[model samples]
Target: MQKPEEAYSIRVIPDVKIVNKGILHTENKIEGEEYRSYIFLNFERITNKGYEASPTIRDDTLYYVNTKRNSLVMQKEFGQPEELFKLGKISKYTFHDKGILVIGEDKTDKKSPFVASKLKYRFDSRGLLRSRLSLYLFSHGELRKVVSGDFDVTDVATNGKRIIISATKEGDDYGLGDLYEVDVETGELKRITKGEGTVVAVAMNEKGEVAYLGHREGKTPWSTAKVILPELGITYQCGKTCGNHVLSDLFDGVKDRLIFEGDVIVSPGQEGGEAHLYLLSDGKSQKMTDGKIVVRSFDYKEGKLVYTYSTPEKPVVLYYEGQTYDPNPDVKGLSPQRVEVNGIEGWAIISGENNPTILFIHGGPHTAYGYAYFIEFQYFARNGYNVIYSNPRGSQGYGEEFAKACVGDWGGKDMNDLLLFVEEVKRKYNLKGKIGVTGGSYGGFMTNWLVTQTNVFSAAISERGISNLVSMCGTSDIGFWFNAVESGVTDPWTEESQMKLMRMSPIYYVKNVKTPTMLIHGEEDYRCPIEQSEQFFIALKMNGVDTILVRYQQDSHEHARRGKPKNMRDRLERKLEWFDKYLKK
Candidate 1:
């Protein structure tokens, strides 16, 4: 095989800030020079499993959960990292002067695993076997269980006194729940906000001002959510007349203004048009960053902003003052052409003439392909393939209605959008040879469905895709609820609903698939599960169709994005080999 294409990966330098002068106003620390020389120093002494959720800064110390170990770690003065709490699957955490509060799954009960195994083969109620996470208080190196129950506490925020949390109760509409405030001492809980929408982020400033991002009950679920300041009794919306898709929570350092990252909606059915740093102050919002570039995860203090900025051709760079640090400087970049098909927006990046084109789809039927640098897309382009990706119906970044268009109609209109996209690109670019298709999760489902619906694709790769919706509903982590919500089938166990699910399943259409397809899945993938790919591979093999299945024993559904570096490379090499074997021939 051709030597692996240029190793292109994006790296983010977190917590890069410029030290401001306190009382000693030295000439060397001039604001202009400080901005220019604020070099991003690589502190190689400290490292941990990828920084979990957002790192909370308290008293000049940084604290964050480690996803790999599910532990809370603290880094003071860039010193050796200290493990504060060894928790499991910490979903959210808040640090205050009193102590640290964490919400995570309690794996203390070893019987939980045995119970899960016992209910593995059971019917729809198997969801009950799953472990329920709870809230805990970590103080003075001791962990105390504060709240333990059925609901999941997410987006935890505290203002030193009161803790504000987004509590998601099971069986709530769309599984979204309300925000509640809890007393730190009394442990009394009070519902602060009630709505049908899903709360994404929550934060409380030092002044006890609670700011949250969520869709109101009647608003479009996909529309940009305004920052709701309940304590201040004000709703802060972006200044852009166009809809703004907020991507992060209001920073905790909010003194006079609220700051966050989001994209201003430029057109209908568009995902991220141009991400910008937005500042809301004095009852109005203002765009803080350059409108042309994409800026994210910014921290503002004392009239200075530190953020990561990138363009389509440049990987993310930590920008503070005028200094810039590029983590992946050696990585090659590609400029993609923005293309629109039937009002659906996408991008096409071509490399080398007469190269086979691969249509890539993103997962999250809710997530959208934006104008950001994607290593995988660049990898494909570097490997002499034209990569075309788009956000069809059901993709976020678009308006609410467009995002919900495919909610109950997966593999229906979205599939048509994909077909039309392929047709448009083929005709627009002309001289089309063979085309390959691939994606993970929902995108994988689309790939499986596409190959069966039509033999247009010469080759296909379905990674962590769902083949049988009915079986998936019972197997996946969020299987039952997600399937029920996405398919609009409230009762998936009913005979009629089961038949409808089977009809929508790609397994039922596998017999019609003629294209050589390779199935890639992580064996430990609970979201889509290995069985989804297993069922598809078996059906294809039984029908004498060309197919192969590659399973990563140590990986999960997120292997492609978050797996070990070696495993990620192996998976990509496998994809390259599969496409080369079939499409190149």
Candidate 2:
């Protein structure tokens, strides 16, 4: 659907101060289907066939890092596509102060079992990073550091003199993170802040002001602090005297002023909600947006402001003038037919006005696709194919019962609900019985599981998915806790339990998959790490199934959802490419 430019919608234009262009996206709460509500209303877009889109621009070019494969890809021209660089787990990069910071690790640790290392890079004017550094936990259980004298030429970030690095630390009691500033020319290290609490976000101002979110002096509450160089003086505190609360990095580096959002968190038994947005300048502040606007994103250019806002009754929209318009209004280029299967309601978002549909299975095993910002489904719909997304059994927000229905029956009832969704969408829409199913995380797991359970889908995209529950039981973030609940396992290693885990694992049943499949993962993701993708890809390829793997470096599970602007764009592009190659006509 094409929207008039004057229509209201929230968007991110190029910031005059940064000369960068990126879109601000949001995911809101879709009311009706509460079962899978957590996964609802995420704002995203599927970009050009292979052309990438990003939320931010860095260096001279836009760069996106895929953490699963451990690679960095750069978007060349404004309207052109991106190219990926394979660096493995050796280095990480970020754009700061018009310079690129490169952090390279020596090797994985044997003591704390280095899942990953903290890296920082500082670049010179010529776009060459002079200092490459790393933060590591030594065998002594103490955090250690390293610096590299080697100079490398990369286009990730090509500006700046001094670079501040952030790293997480593990100690005898608990874990925290540290921040360090390194001299690019000399490879000299200056420890900025360490110990106690983690530095969540960092922003450096033109006047050498470093603003960040951190906990100070073993304090219980997290606050935003603006610190000065040299003596490391703390000037401003957003939450210091306000009590226990977390401030947004959006408040950092606002220059002379701080935007204080009153009480971001809603305490237990609290009614309604409140937030305050303002511009802090010269130790004084002015209100920017009212607290009642229900804004998820806002960007100010010149004196005009563009933002997105919605109420419970209205779908998400952007604002301009006095009117609001939908950025993606049910893609007129395509047609989707609604369907209800086995008492479950759903619809197929088609690629074109007429074509077979791609059955988009949502994760949470209990989540549903409703009126929210989904660029992928819209992309497929606009491109002339049908895409179907549904909230199957075990999805959330459907009161607590429906959300918990699939809790213990991972591969059983939830899978059945999806299959029924597909059958009903096909029957209702006359979809020619051709469907391509895809999802990420839990959805990826389901896609992997789906191909094994049925040959219905012609193709599948399993993104950052799980294949082996037995292995994942020992690897994932909450594997230990959730695996027992799902598999009813008393001992993860026990033969009987292992067999059951295998039975439910999609990789084990790869021999039954007839549909071509693709696997995408982030190398740095702690949630559903690359191992799961690797195992699934290997199994499928070994079984002679058409399979491909795309891995992004330094990209955690949060990359696709929320990472650097460039990464977010590249993720959507790559995902669309996979679907374009397999699901599209």
Candidate 3:
């Protein structure tokens, strides 16, 4: 049988930003493998295949970062490219009053060594903190270093005078960071935000006015972030905020989505699982873009809106004036039936009649399974298994109350929501044979927890799941603060806190789990870590439950969504094999 990855060959285009030449984005075939970029000038490919990224416009001319040479390149009006500042693997860059504010690192800088001296020493995907990113103001054919300190500058926005930057110091704040303002002349760095929640997206005006998309404080993981105009002391929050709340196989931070165009501020907003572009002006928020689509990245200027978006039926495609530039044109994937049950929103993709069911859970209890194309879901459907996934309590896109509903109660009502979804789905569809459950990250935790509570599922697979909150604090990256905040055990060293963590842990109840289970994890996944899977696998093995552990080398938390094609194909084949072995028999 043809696999779904082969049948629905998705060409993922992410890091898309609008430019004068049209839109610039990186396209790849195997999910988050953004190795090459292209410029769609009048919907035509302008550049050849190379490791290109961070495409930006400076005074009508296009410039992008070339990873192969570790330098910046200039693409002139669908013509040849010129290599500019040869920085070390440019992370992000923007033009200033004189030239460009380059946010990258120096490859051979030995003055300051990257020491893991802080409480939180590492981050997910990027691995350990090895280099310090410096800010440089390039002017008059010369580069001047701006602020290079203990903080890591991830993003920046400038009106040519005062530059607004979102950075995190070598503290224990995790992702919760603050913003700063730097004078272009004196290079005077001033604090803007009070280190509340993370400043995910930022924009600035000529008057040094600033508006950012972030949360005041994300008490729970599902807390909805807000768009704040701090200079005017105005906050425009209406069931929305900027960031990638919609979960998919594509992996890249959505930047340049919030921009100040003329008098209006265009920002992305989420409502119920679908995301769209919104215009914020004079304290009022207006929904600018429409449809059941998730707007990932966009650029708007002078009433023209060009955005990178996706639906359950389509992958990431550029949209402007009813025109779409699809990187993958001929590939067609299965669509889903959107459903809601007891305030829980879900999608069901049916491939055949009376087929076995696969209850796929989304990772981040914070991230929602929205109206976006997912190859894994299509993979299950192509194998004659109906897929059902839902966003229950503790999911974004819903209001703050709904999002925070599962704050300290992970396996309580959230578990009920999944159970209710399965019940409603089976009642609504002709689900025959046996049902299998699978999920990664937080979804993986739920998959493990579900089998312990009920023996309904015949086979279960948990990828990069959390089994013990107490041990997670000591082992995983962001585990100390993240597990504490989510479980409300601010101090896990205490006896009571340990009991609370144990009560919420699926491993604590492994004795009750009778379903045959399989564990898959990456060797380098610091977010949930491989130890999480190892613990669960051993517990199930000791309990005499049919279990096996599959470990992928040199892969991280995103191995399933964005791993090597060989490993990804093997994962899909194993998934089909496991389900067919148990469910088909």
Candidate 4:
């Protein structure tokens, strides 16, 4: 959708030190591309170098892990980043309120079981570290390493029971994950759930009781059970189907609201899987909102819930200095237009006042395309493409019932939703002759799926997508979990596996593809590893399909989206070029 004159165009946010950083924190990017390398934290006035994506702010201090440096640093007075500890040869340092913590094998003279360590520090009410404490490692040697320096901390939360710290880690197989809770004080560690396939999410109530989500294990795709203090001999179970839930967002600090470690559920597979907020009050659990909502953050003055919301239809707007600006302005220019496609309600975005549109497909067949801020979508809009993305059948923003509708169906009904959505957009926008499609992960799978099943779009780009369920079952980090849940397949390789998985796999229908397709992948990605791309690429080439494959060797499963600065820039450029070659009129 690039205008003839828009070629050789560059977008730079004027005077604003805002970087279009990826979602997860990692250093992976294509070489020699234009991108935002540094961004200044508006509140802390801290200028973060390299890729500083997710920031956790607490007590006026800001905490972030630099993937480029592979180190954790603290910044006070918005000064230079101070190195607190080197997790070198180990894993990256995770930031907590007191200090940075690392979890890994306790490698020392006395090797012990898995151990987690933290650096201690003294901080003021504003959250700037006043002094440093002995580096505390729960390892055997009994010797703690202390590094002296001031610290920067933020996004610190506590229910007067425990200090909760949020950070990310490189998973064994699924690239990097956004993790929470270092438990610096009580030495209690817990993983707050996000992404897909997470059965349970844990939180702490005011009484220090742990709340956890209890879902049916394995691939049976049962109901979800929200349990409060199940591990502490106290139990309150919300009896619901236990399908995989992805925590879309969270809110903390509600007056008289009891949130335990286990009282969280992403979107269950019943409705559209649209996320909703619930609270336990007066010994009764109550549903808060009825529509699709994602809790970005919470402001509690004396523990009263002020307001919380997320971007699903509109970009998140922030009021600053008596002025309002779209925090996700990349999506600011996009105008959300609604239309009914074959009796299915859907939405699409029109960029600016002109240009051909790119049909943006989201992953999670059960996930909904709501008002969320997506950088990729923004860039597509910035580059003069009307990027239209939606949450089809499996999307979470709808509700539990709609989300579950795609469970065993896979690409059947969901595929129809996308096709109908596109048809509706075309009719509404009078854009019948020009259209393009692209997505990653499940979205990627669908891109591949779409290219084979139909030639609706002029071009396609599939990133970290899947082609064959059989190979993906073994190659993916969560393939076992995915196969079991969606297809109810005990053995991915067996012919008797889910009929839909085989029928929907793009590789089975590659011969029907006529669109010029491009494949992008991260070499080390184990979740939806490079093998998925490779399988599709091989099939396309063998069938004489017009295809190209680009792989980022330095990245893993995450780097594809959240990799280095240079790589992100290159990816956008390449993607634009691919679409330009085919989609542009």
Give the candidate number with the greatest lDDT.
3
**lDDT scores of the candidates, listed in order:** 0.66, 0.49, 0.78, 0.51
- Residue 156 in candidate 1 has what lDDT? 76
How many clashes in each structure?
Answer: 1, 59, 0, 68
What pairs collide in candidate 3? none
- In the range 65-116, model 4's lDDT, one tens digit per residue, is 5545544445554566665544322232333334444432222332344332
TM-score of each: 0.81, 0.49, 0.94, 0.66
Weakest 10 consecutive residues, lDDT, candidate 4? 248-257
Better of 1 and 3 by TM-score: 3
- Judge candidate 2 at residue 361 and give its lDDT: 66
Best-to-worst ranking by lDDT: 3, 1, 4, 2
| Candidate 2: tens digits of C-alpha lDDT, residues 159-221 | 244455554422201224455565554446566665565444444443444544444534221
lDDT score for residue 481 of model 1: 68
For model 2, the superposed segments whose C-alpha errors exceed 4 Å read 1-338, 350-353, 563-585
Flag regions of model 4 displaced more than 4 Å.
1-200, 213-279, 283-294, 299-301, 304-331, 340-345, 351-355, 498-501
Alpha carbon lDDT at 386, candidate 4: 75
Please report how far candidate 1 places residue 162 from its true position, in Å: 2.3
Which scores better on lDDT, 2 or 4?
A: 4
